[model samples]
Target chain A: MLTLKQDHSTLIVLSVLADGPSYGYAISKAIAAKSDGHFKLTASGMYPLLTKLEKQGLVTTSWEEVKAEGADPDATGRRRKWYTLSPKGHKQLAKHIEANRQMQALLDAFVAPAVNDQNAHA
Target chain B: MKHTHGNTPKPKPPTSRDGIETWLDVLTSMLSLPSSQRTQVRDELEDHLRSRVDDLLVLGKSEAEAIRTAISELGETAQLARHISSASRTPKSFRRFAMNATFFVLAGSVLTASVSMMIPTHTNTTLPGATEAIVVETAEVTEPIRHRFNHEREPVVDVLQSIATAYGLSFRFSDGVRKSPFGKTILDTQLNTFKGEYTLKEAIDAFQARMYMTYGETVLAMTENELILMTLEEHKRMQIEIQAYQIPSWAESDDDQRNYGFSIEQLISTKHDLEYTTIQPVNGSLVVAAPPEVHAEIISMAAQLEAIGKSMQAQKTQQRIEQHAQMTRRIDRLRAEYEAAKSVYFAEREKANEFSNRIDELRSRRLFVRSNDELSKEQQEALQTQINNLGEQSKQQEITTDEAKARFERLQSILIDAESELILSDINDALPIEGMNDSKDEMRTVSIMGTANMRSGIYQLPEAGKLTLARFLMAADVQDPNGKVLLQRGGVSEPIGTVGDISSGTIDSIVLLPDDQVVITAAD
Candidate 1:
């Protein structure tokens, strides 16, 4: 799970983040849940990346008070600062998506007919 | 595939001034991170950590354990930092290149280009305040152009200080930090003396004696145990003085004016001592006998001693449990054996007694009937046999009683010895440190130039007190060549002699104390 290629990791993160802006915890959980118990991030690994993105101004932040139902009114609100990708982040995402699409097309053009011919022979 | 890689989530910036130094050391050592990158890395790491910790707490982990587990995942700080750097252009990622301690990364086209771009051209460099502009090239380290600037010109910023006039020139020396130059000199001398091969007391005394000679005619200086009065008045708080238990009087006493470490028991003794009560300018040479409790208080000082005594208390409690178990078994076994032997011996003796009584009754009846001469020979022989049986059983019971008594005495001796061993160990540990931890407060000393003379009169008599201890000493214990006695009496110690003292004779590192003296122990 850990030794996945860096490009594969980038794809996974983009897919998870596309749903909504989430803080470090929710985002990490989104990745794990979407992968169905395939991957997780250590705090050390995830936090630095979040900070780097914020530093790059590719993500913006907002604090939200998310209260659970039947919770004590006096208890501290589930206030968390959420992080979402900015316009620049979206543009960068689009470029990567295009590159991935081109790679996929190349693979389909070169290897699809060959794989089909082999299957037919069998 | 758009991933923000270099983002390290640090906890919100720690707002404590206290943790700066400690955290600096921790972070530097942990990451082996360069000084320049420290702040950014630390801030970012801290912010991310806080959020993650908050996340963990939400995820059902304890705040403490979550923080611990979160820190654990950092996975050898250096590697994680490198990975984070690859994700972004954070300075922590660029640390290796900045310090010029990088591997030959010829493959890094981007890094190579950036390095080339960073080196400034020589045309921009010039010497300050020189008519002939000296354009020095930093690119080539082949030549040197030393600037004629006064390197020692006082720093441009005096804005951080409130300057004051002292002696004549404007000075920033803290007058509040030192009451008198005499104290400053004494402490300075003491510190200097302790900086090398010197004992603590020797340093104190040598500096003190120098002070005595210098300021001999000034205010009366207190000497040794007579240095200050230890009293309950000093103990404003019930803080335990565990470091060999020497409570500074300045901290304890309401009279914080006097600055010196006050011995807690020494203070207690001052309050209890009649000498302190009678300490007025007396008319005669009064030999006042201090109360007997003075000795007991001194002895009781063993309680104030911390680490060693606490360990003894814990160890003795353990021993008591063990002794109780063993003693219970021994007593039970002895009692069982003795009871069995005793019952058999006594029962046989009882039968002999019954036979003897019958014989005596028969003889009495013969006498009453006036037929004393017609006694049967078989009856007389049977009475004799019963008398012999009675003697044997009595002897057997005596043996049983002696055997039981002997076993009881053996158990008693063992218990006594065990208890004694515990007491001795604790006692050896309780020897008061002569002067390693002196007072942190000020003493009003009359000064002669730079030396602090503590004696009221010139070279006043040092109040001698005996310090007897039971360490297995074969000399070589003290740092000085004082033949183990150090200094017997009024001799002035070596000038500025303060660092060395009675070192461990090391009758083995340590051992347990007896249960009885667990309340007061010296076993370190």
Candidate 2:
């Protein structure tokens, strides 16, 4: 499994919210499910990253009352904190994706030579 | 329904719930965010943990097992606290520097505007000696001379004289220029060292800036004297026209007019080279030849005096308005009091009239009772007289309601007593007079008896012609007199069973007269 970079987490969070508004648990679940259990997101890492993104005006948060499917009408099921990508967050995510594509191309050249050396030894 | 009765165990409180709460409390206390922000963070974390526990519970784990797994997935509290604290810390010093710079710029703008308003603008008015035709022919210097000298605590005029001596120029003061008030003020000024190297014109400009004086080069042609130093005000004279109303009115006396004129002359003489001259002979208008600065000063003084006059007129008008307001307030108060008193008097008069009408009604009832067949003519006449007197007293306006009530009570008592007396007189008339015919002797024994009880006997005297009373002896037992008995002639009642016992030789005789009258005689 590849270790996610510090700025990669913020980009991933923003990209997930760019689709629609999502809460902390839903955003973490989506990242894990999309990466096929390879990238595990923790609450400790995601909450502070969300707080920093909110302070930098890259994302915004709001509290929503979400009731469970079978909950009683008067019951308060849960308080979910929802985050959405700001216009500034959309611009920053696009810039980060473009940079990652160039970095991937640069790494591809080095990886091709290393694989050929392994193939010769085999 | 099946009924099962047995000892049921109480449900235990959730241990993992307590553990999550304790962890949140510790984490929030460790973070340095504001309390409101810290509460938001705690709520968010708790919600996340509960959601995880709910997901685990759907997998058929016990509540305790689900809570433990949720907390372990959330990660350690200390690491989360450190990350949140670092993220939320503000850069205080940078914000403070920006605030201070903003304040300094605002203050500097205000100070610059104020200083620009205070400095006066300079005007290019030609001086008297600025014409080259009036310039003195002294030794012309091909190059400018620069002097570098320092003098500590020297008088300003002495410093200027030393500068003139170094330039080989003779300097003298114009007439009255040195002795003027402005000259006296500048002469007393002690200047510190003004050390610099400058040309002659530059040095003189600096010296004039400090002393507020200028050099007169035309004195060589005009006064045939050396270079003259006079105040800047003496060099520029202008004629100012004054209207008649601008001159303050003088008092009635001629001495007052002369004193005022002398004061104007003295003020002009002390401050400027000018004289007060009348412009129009009849209207009290005048013209003064003075420098523009001195003319401005005089105009300012006139404005101050006019302002004082207007202020005094306004004060007088205000005092009159205040006095009128005070009188109006007093009149309003008195009018209100009179209205209140009038209402009270009307109420009292209404009550008195009510009582008077009641008394009149009661008197009419009494008159009807007196007119009945039971009352005798004399008793009716007496009762009518009493009612008339009460009516006369009650008709007077000053008679209060209580006095009328008291008079009604008295009339009632008098009528009751008169009725009783008339009934008693009727009973007395029915009594027998049997022993009166047997008593013809001057010393005859007589027996007096009556059905009504009496304690004393009443007799009429023969010669003196008056009724007299005689007490009954102790042996004479009379019953209680329940009814009244009237004794005629004296019209008095005496108890029955009273008789005369003669024991002295002075013969006292008793005679029974006709018509039931008994007469007693005493020897003279």
lDDT of 1 by residue, B447-504 (tens): 1111121111111111111122222111112222122221212233222111122223
lDDT of 1 at B402: 61
The TM-score that candidate 1 achieves is 0.28
State which candidate has the highest DockQ.
2
Residue-wise lDDT of candidate 2 within B327-439, one digit each (tens)? 44654565565555555555556776765686677677667876676777887676677667656655664355445455545555554454333323222221111111111
Q: Which portions of model 2 show Cα errors greater than 4 Å?
A: A1-3, A68-72, A75-77, B1-18, B93-524
- Residue B478, model 1: lDDT of 20
Model 1, docking class: incorrect
Chain A only: TM-score per candidate? 0.71, 0.85
Q: Rate the local accuracy (lDDT) of all candidates.
A: 0.37, 0.49
DockQ of each: 0.05, 0.07
**Residue B90 of candidate 2: its Cα lDDT?**
47
For each of the candidates, give the backbone clash count: 55, 5
Question: Per-residue lDDT for B123 in model 2?
Answer: 27
Measured with C-alpha atoms, the lDDT of residue B99 in candidate 2 is: 16
